[model samples]
Target: MSRIVFLEERCKGCRLCVEACPAHILRPSGRFNHQGYEIMEMDGQCTGCASCAVMCPDTAIRVFRSVKIRNTAGEGAA
Candidate 1:
């Protein structure tokens, strides 16, 4: 699983993230931000590919990938 963070205040609501997301997980908010632009947020379907992050001109979005842990005992048993 991965974590997606959206910085609404910094967003310009240009829909660039939504358009760049390959999974189509990002959506426009119904309410506008202080800048009067519709905010963009990631939904549950996000794959964490960072496509949106790369496309965002304002650099308001961040994607964090979860680290996988391996059991040392299991490796010894193998």
Candidate 2:
């Protein structure tokens, strides 16, 4: 699965990340951070592509992609 973390205080309510997300998984949270700016959050499917993070001018977005593997015994591995 892919995960996106938005650094609320570092965000300035710019929609750059939203526009950059190819997966269209980002959206405004309708909530404000300590800086009084609306933050972004994940709202849909994510392809683990780093487009959003790369387009974030404030460096407020972090993307983590975890690789899950299954063994022949049907066990999950990290």
Angstrom error at residue 28, model 2: 0.5
User: What lDDT tens digits, residue by residue, belong to model 2 across residues 1-78?
Assistant: 889899899999998999988888899999999979999999987788989999999999888997877567745655
**Top lDDT prediction, candidate number:** 2
Per-residue alpha-carbon lDDT of candidate 1 for residues 36-66, written as tens digits (9 for 90 to 100): 8888776776677898899989999999987
Which clashing pairs does model 1 show? none
- Lowest lDDT 10-residue stretch of candidate 1: 69-78
Candidate 2 residues lying further than 4 Å off, grouped into runs, are 68-78
Best by TM-score: 2
TM-score per prediction, in order, is: 0.81, 0.83
Displacement of residue 46 (Cα, Å) in model 1 is 2.1
